[model samples]
Target: EPLPYSAILQPGHTLGMMGGGQLGRMFCHAAQSLGYKVVVLEPTEESPAGRVAEYEVVSAYDDMKGLDTLLSYTQAVTTEFENVPAASLKYLSSQIRISPSAAVVAVVQDRIAEKTFIASQGIPVAPYAEIRTIEDLEKADNTLFPAILKAARLGYDGKGQARVKSVAEAVEAFKSFGEVPCVLEAMLPLKKEVSVVMARGFDGKIALFPIGVNTHINGILSSSVVGVEEIDPTIEKAAQEAAIKIALGLNYFGVMCVEFFILEDNRLVANEIAPRPHNSGHYTMNACLSSQFEQQVRVLAGMPLGSTDLLAPTIMLNILGDSWFAHGGEQAIEPDWASVLALPGVNLHLYGKAEARKGRKMGHINIVNKDPQQLIYYARQVSDILH
Candidate 1:
């Protein structure tokens, strides 16, 4: 598993990215900057990456003609989102090399499967059960009452989860959620949410990014202040070790995100994993020695992984779709645009999207400093403007 410089690709080669959202947009910029060409495989005519990348194929990832075109033009393939269909990845793998493997997609796509695999690996996860039917739900222990129920597939931004007060509430919640199979879990009184973002090189080497302290509004991530607070050295080590284990086990060869819930008791519970660059990691664009997107391109391009150290204490605030709406003719999400621009060490990245719906991530801003209080103050300053 040494660095596969001969077997893997390098800068100046084209990477086919299978998604065209903001993540892909930043990825396109990163790859292009690293001397790698980029081709976006997206169905959206106005995809953000299509606007930024060198070339784009306007077809679904599952389309064979599109896949053929992607493989013919690109040296390797990667994805911006973890939920990209495993079948589509398998098809692409037949024609071109794919990093992170389709099996990683298959596992991370479903909550039940992901938790099961993590638990099997002796990783800590919340007490949970998969419910495919009323009977399955009924089997949930009463001790696990007041649980968080989430759809097994396509759940993001708090879009497909509900909190149930009781077993009776679980039944109604399931019915309201179309009665599909889902994950029901005991709700932990989380002290805070944190995330660890890392990249694994083609040689099976792992690079751990600075941890992010995340804040969510209504179960949807709103802002992330980098680095956790009051963390035991052992807990920090455990989090990194857990990430290395999962990424290596899944044969992942690119950037990945692992979110954790730190309970009041100081135990770290693995909340979920994203086998791609994550929203929380956006702070790295300005604060990390190597941006996650750039590091990802390097990893997939046969280069050694770069440093994961933070350049400064960073504060990142997300501009959700609500920010795009005009309120009294003002951008609702404007994070003190002029004030932020005036502040030193502040950087802005806007995703070129035509339209924004409620709760959709529109863009992000990062502020760097040495003081955590100053970082949080500036973060709140921005969040207040946008929120």
Candidate 2:
């Protein structure tokens, strides 16, 4: 039986967030905009979200006092990152409810468990094998070639992943990543990378945002465009179905992202899962009826769900502050904001932070276009000028 709204959460109440990154900041804005309070549990004093949230607990994840204080006010808790320390989550789970609970977090935290779950669900994934030692790496030899070595835990933003193109590279890459448990996956010659970001409310109501097409540069997400240029209904259906299954199977009440690789045959093979609002879905803010952040708030607040339909075809360019060209500067290197703003349908969001580093995400820009190709060209131009 489905749980009642009152049993799950209350509106105009507080939602506690586990991490204080930019995602946290956007989620706080969404929650606060809708008349809900937010409590940010962050490790850094200068956390972007913590700076703006209603109540800020600037302490480690294990800070009992901070956790206790947050739980006292918030009706439910959620997270912006999947790498939260399970011990701290366990501590809080014993006291207050954490939606998309600890089990989902634990399962997604380890690459092995994630792959196992995907396979058990009969979902198609890249051919992969596990590695715990040099011997295990050798066993992966005949299984898959042109593979990637990935850490089983705590890896994101393209870190802890190394591509092995040749026989000797596999041996060296495994050793390079050291004694950590790992998974080696066959590299697919993908036609395009797209992702589905969706939210499942406590009422078992699932709303899916548009699928996003992602492009990467030097192992980092450089850009994401929403709504497949030539709407692949088959792909779209499969992507949304996968998200629904994952969210319901996880018994979740929050936003979740599943990245997909469009095989040459047009089949959708999942790349990975993100248990929070994803960078690829940033386009939703300008293109959708309701942003993913707001959808997350709605879900966690046990409120009516938001529409997932895209209002316009949109393109998003990430502002990685640490780009060697311009983003790496400690001080802000202002983009030609006037020029960018002059462009029709352009929306810019800059995260207010003191310092900028190499490859660190600072902000993003969105463009809703009647012509996606033209928008892509202009976006590249603006992003090039910005970086």
Candidate 3:
């Protein structure tokens, strides 16, 4: 049952966030904008969200003292990343409200469990086989070769994954990962990738944002373009419905994302689920009537969900740490932000990270315009400027 509004919706009340990355930073901004105070629980001394939050609990995720401190301050809590210890969420849920409960996070954090859950929902997922031991790898069917061997846990941003063409290669990769549990997924025909970002309320109401056509470079999302011209109406609706079905299946609350692989035949296969606001949905900050972060805040506070209507054609470009050294230098050099900002319809957002390392997500740019073509053109210009 949902908590009474008086318990959480009161102005100046505190909210809790687990994980202090860019997503939590944005969630803090949204919560504060709605007259709420946010306290972040992250072990890092300096974090993107910690720097902006009203308070910071600098302790490990499972630290009892830390959780108690956070609980003492906030009536509700939400996680910024899926990898946050599910035990920590479960502990908190015994007291305060936690969105996307520990049970939901537990399922999504492991690739094997996540894939099985999606397939069980009657959703189409890529052909995959679970590999927990050398024997399991040997037993894997030859037809599933030319597959990606992914760690079932603690893998993200293209990490903990390897592409193999044979069972021998898969065995070697499995051994390389300390024989940890993994999933071998068959490679599919080439086509496009897309994602749907939606927010589900405690009342079972859901609001979905527009489908984002995503492009990934080296396993990291490079850009996401959302516009009527970017995808067929039928595919968009199908993706949204599948995402909603998954959210319902999980009995989820707060924001979540469902990534889809659109095959060459135009069939949509569920790739994975993100149990929080996703990077692909960053365009919502500038393009939609209500940003995903704001929706997260509303749901946590027991407030009504906000409108997700797209206000304009938008393109989101990820800014990696590589950009800081794009000028061929051992020392990092700042990109020409002045040139990029000079372009009309360009909105820049930089996460408050202290250092820039190759492959690190430092920030993002959202380009919005009424004309879809112009938006893409602006995105290209911004990409050129950043590179």
Candidate 4:
């Protein structure tokens, strides 16, 4: 049964966050805006979210003192990153509310387990095989050649994955990845990639944002455009329903994302699920009536989910640290933010990190306008400056 409103957190109560990345930073903004206090448990002294939070415990996630301190201040907790140790959530849940519980996070943390859960829900996914040992590789079907071997855990942003065209290549890639447990997924004839970001309330009410068309470069997301043009209406509805079905099956509470691949034949295949606000949904911050971050806060606080209606067409461009360094990586060159911001509809957000390394997420820009064509044109201009 759904938790009742008596569990609904009041405005003045403090909320706890597990990870202190950009997602946590945005969540703090939303919670604070609603007159709630947030305490962040992050070891980093200068984490993006820690910098903005009212109280920050600069201790490791496993530190009992830090966890206790966070619990002392907050009645409810949520995690920004999914890889946070499940044990931490299990320990804290005995005391306070933790939305998208440890069980849900655990299932999504491992690639094989996540895909298995999605498939069990009657959702279609790519053909794949598991590789925990050399014998597992021997048992893999030859037709799955030209597959991508991905680490079962701790993989993100295109890291911890390698493409293999044969069993020999798969063996080498597995060894290169420290012989970790992995999943080898057959590549599909992908025509486009898109994602749906939605919020499931404590009462199981669901609110969905419009489909976001995503473009990635080198396994890292490069851009996302809301209100994708020329998409088949029936396909879009099916994708949205599939995401909702997955959320309902998990009995999830909070903003969640389901990524999909539109095949050459126009079939939509579930790619992966993110149990938190997604990077592709960053456009929601400016384009929607209520941002995904705010939805996260509402769900965790046991409050009603907010409206997800798109206020306007928007395009989001990711700014990576590679843009700060020239092609040779010799000279540091910061993009002309002033020039980019000069665009009428462009909104720039930079995470305050002191050092810039290759492929690191530095910030993002959102371009909002009535005409999708104009947003696309401006997005290209902005991308040129950043890249």
Order of candidates by lDDT, top first? 3, 4, 1, 2
* Models ranked on TM-score: 3, 4, 1, 2
Show where candidate 4 strays beyond 4 Å: 1-6, 327-329
Question: Regarding TM-score, does 1 or 4 come out ahead?
Answer: 4
lDDT comparison, 3 vs 4, better candidate: 3
lDDT of 3: 0.92
Deviation of model 2 at 249, angstroms: 2.3
**How would you encode candidate 1's per-residue C-alpha lDDT over 1-387 as one tens digit per residue?**
222344767677888899999999999998888888999999889899988888899998788898888877886788998778899988777666677679889999999999998887789999998999998888889888889899999999888899998989999999999998899999998987888999988777788887888989988887787752556678888888888887777777889999998899989899899988999899999888889998878877878888888877888888777765636444444435787677666788889877667677878889887887777777766656665
Which numbered prediction scores highest in lDDT against the true structure?
3
Query: Residue 314 error for model 1, in Å?
Result: 0.4
Model 4 lDDT tens row, 222-326: 889887476789999999999998998887888999999999999889998898999999999999989999999999998888889988889999889898875
lDDT of 1 at 178: 96
TM-score preference between candidates 3 and 4, better one: 3
Candidate 2 per-residue lDDT over residues 126-151, each given as its tens digit: 88888888888776656588888888
